[model samples]
Target: MAGAQRLAQTLAGRLDTTFTKVGTPRTPLDADWQAQLASALPELRQLAETLTLRLVEGHKPLAVLPRCAAALATLPVIARHHPDACLIWLDAHGDLNTPASSVSGYLGGMVLTAAAELWDSGLGSGWRLDQVVLADGRELDQAELALITQYDIRHLTSESLTPEALSQAIGNRPVYLHLDCDLLAPGLMPTEYSVAGGPDLAQLYALCSAIGHHELIGLEVAEFEEQPDFAMAEAAEALCDALAPVYERLYR
Candidate 1:
C-alpha cells in the first residue's frame, strides 16, 4: 500500500472527510500520459463541485498536483469563484526544477514546473509561481534557486505562519494548500524525501493554524512514506492536528 492511502485512511478516521480512492497514473511523461491525466481530471472536478475542503492523497507530490491541474481545467465553477486562488507550497525542496535543470531527474522534483507549465497554457486556471508561498523550502537545487530569484517566489521563513505575511503574499485570494511531509524537520519521521533544518512538527502545525484565517479551497498531502511501529501513524496524526483549523473550516 502506498503511504498516501495509509495516511488518508488514518486522517479519515480522525477528520471529517469522505474517502474516495483513485488509481495512480503509471504512464511516463509523454502525450499519452497527458491524455490519460486529462481523462482522470473530472473525478477531482466533481469533488470540487461540492465546494468543500477536499483532501487528496497521493504517493508523490507529482502524482497529485499535475493531475490536479488537469482537473481544475474542467472546473469552471472553481475558476469563476476563485480566479485569484494562491498556493501555499509546503515542502523542504523548492520543487521548481524544470526537466533541463534537475540534477536528480526525479519526476517529483519536476512537479511544480509541470504544474506551472500547465497553468502557463491556461489549463487549470491555477495560481502562477509568484502566487506560491514556498514554506520551509530549504533543499532547493541551484537551478531552482536561480529561477526563484528570477521569479521572486516568496519563501516562508517565519517560525509561525503569519496571516499578515500570507495575506501580503496573496491578498484576499482563496488558498490551495499543499504539504510535503518531507518538509518536517529532520528526524521527525522517515519521509520519502528528507532534508535538513526544516521546521519541526510544532512549528509546522503553527503554520497550518495560521492558515485558518484564509479562504482555503483545497489541500493535498504527499511525500509521506509508511514506517513500522506506528511511526508513520504518529507523523500523520501530527499533520492532522496541525491542519485541524483548516479541516474544521472546510468541514463546517
Candidate 2:
C-alpha cells in the first residue's frame, strides 16, 4: 500500500498532476468479499470526480481486477462528458476471464474481462472492448488466450513487441495507459508480484513515446511491490523520464 502511494505521488509529481490515494484490504473471491469490494464504490466515484490526479487503494491481486473494472466502468461516462479517451493496458497477464472459468480463481486476472464485458457479474458497464489496447502481456492462460483470440483485441506481447511494433499498434488513439510494473523484465522491475519476461527499456520508451504523442487522457501504474532487490523509487523515476516527452508535447 505504501509503495503504491509512493508510486502515485511520484507519478503525479513528475506529470504535474494531483494524486488521490485509496486503500482496499485483501479479500478472497467469494460472495461476501465481493460485497466488501462493492462497498468502496462511493469512494471510488468521488475520487474519480475529476481525473486530474487520483490514486485509489489497490491490493490483493484478485480484488484489484474487480476494482479496476468498476473504476473503468465509470470512465466511459467520464469520457462521454469529455470525449477523447482510450485505454492502454500494460501487464503480464490478459486479465480476461469469467468467474466460473478462472482456474486460479485470481480476481485480478479477470479485470480485463470485466472491462470487456466478458465477466458475468462485476464492473457496471463501460467502454467497448475495442477501446482497450493490451500492451506487453507475455503470459496468458488457455482460457484467457481463447478470449483474446475470439475478441481479436489489439495486443502486443512482451517477447514479440519491438518499439516499432508498439508504435504501430497504438497508432493514434486518445489513451489512458495503465502500466502494471510487472510488464518490465524481472531484473529491471523486481517489485512486481509476477515476472514473466517483458519488454526491455528501449521498447518501453518507444511505446511511451507513441502514447504521449497521441492523445492521452490519463495514466495509471499499478502492482509495484517494494522488494530488497528492487528499487521502486528508481523505477518510478525512470518511468517519469520515459513519459516526460509525452507531457512536454501535450502541454506545449
Candidate 3:
C-alpha cells in the first residue's frame, strides 16, 4: 500500500488535485481471511459508495487500491453502474477460484469470483461473465483453467496483445481496466507477489495507449509493494508516464 500512496500523491500533485483516503486499518487483524474480510466490510462499503457517487456524478474513476481483494468492493460498483461495461482484467493469476476450490485460501485470488457472485460477499451484485476479459495471466491454477474452459472466458496472452486484439477482446462495450502490478515482468517493478514471466513496462505503455482508444469508465491498480532501494515516488512517476495515455483520455 506504500507504493499506491506514493503513486496517488505523485498523480495528485501533477494534476493539482487532492486524493481522499476512505479509511485505514488502525492495526493488523489477528484473525483468518474470512474474519479479516468481515472486519473490513464497513470500509469496503464506504469505497463502493464513493465510486458509485462519482459514476453517478458523471466522473470517470481511477482508483489506486492496496490489494486486489478490494475489487470485491469496486468491481460491483462498476458493473452495476454500467451494466454493459466489460472489465479488462490484467493480472498474473486468474483470481477465479471459489472458496471450495482455492487451496491457499487467499481472498485476493478469489476476488473476481466473488465479484461474479460465485460466492455471496454481502457487498453488492456480481458481474456478468460474458462481459469479462482476462489478459496476461501467466500463472493459472488447474482449477482456474477448468473455470476458464468451462465458462469459455476470453483469455489473452501477452504475445498476442495489439490494438486489434485488445479491441476484439473488449468488443463494443465500454471498458473498465483492472491492473495488478504483478502483471509486469519481475525485477521491472516491486510487487508483493510476482512470478517469472509477463509483459514489460514498454508493453504496459502500449497496452494503456491502445485501451485509451476505447470508451473507458475506470482504472484500478493493485498489489504494488514498497522497495527501500527503489525510490517510491520515482517509481510512481514512471508508472504515471506509462499510464499517461489512459489518464489523459480519462481526465480529458
Cα deviation of 49 in candidate 1 (Å)? Answer: 11
TM-score of 3: 0.95
Instruction: Please give, for residues 39-105, the per-residue lDDT of candidate 1 as tens digits.
Output: 5456545444443333222111112222223333323333345566677877777778765776765
| Local accuracy by lDDT, each model | 0.61, 0.59, 0.84
**Most TM-score-accurate candidate:** 3
Q: Could you give candidate 3's per-residue lDDT for residues 1-252 as a string of tens digits?
A: 666777778777867788878777456677766988998899999999999999899999989888898888999999888888989988888889888999988888988888888888778766867677888788889999998888778888667766678878886788999999998888777787988988888888988988999998989888876788776766788788888878788898
Better of 1 and 3 by lDDT: 3
Best by lDDT: 3
| Steric clash pairs (candidate 1) | none
- How close to the true structure is residue 205 of candidate 2, measured as C-alpha lDDT? 75
Model 2 / residue 182 / CA error / Å:
0.2
In terms of lDDT, which candidate is stronger, 2 or 3? 3
Higher lDDT: candidate 1 or 2? 1
Arranged by TM-score, best first: 3, 2, 1
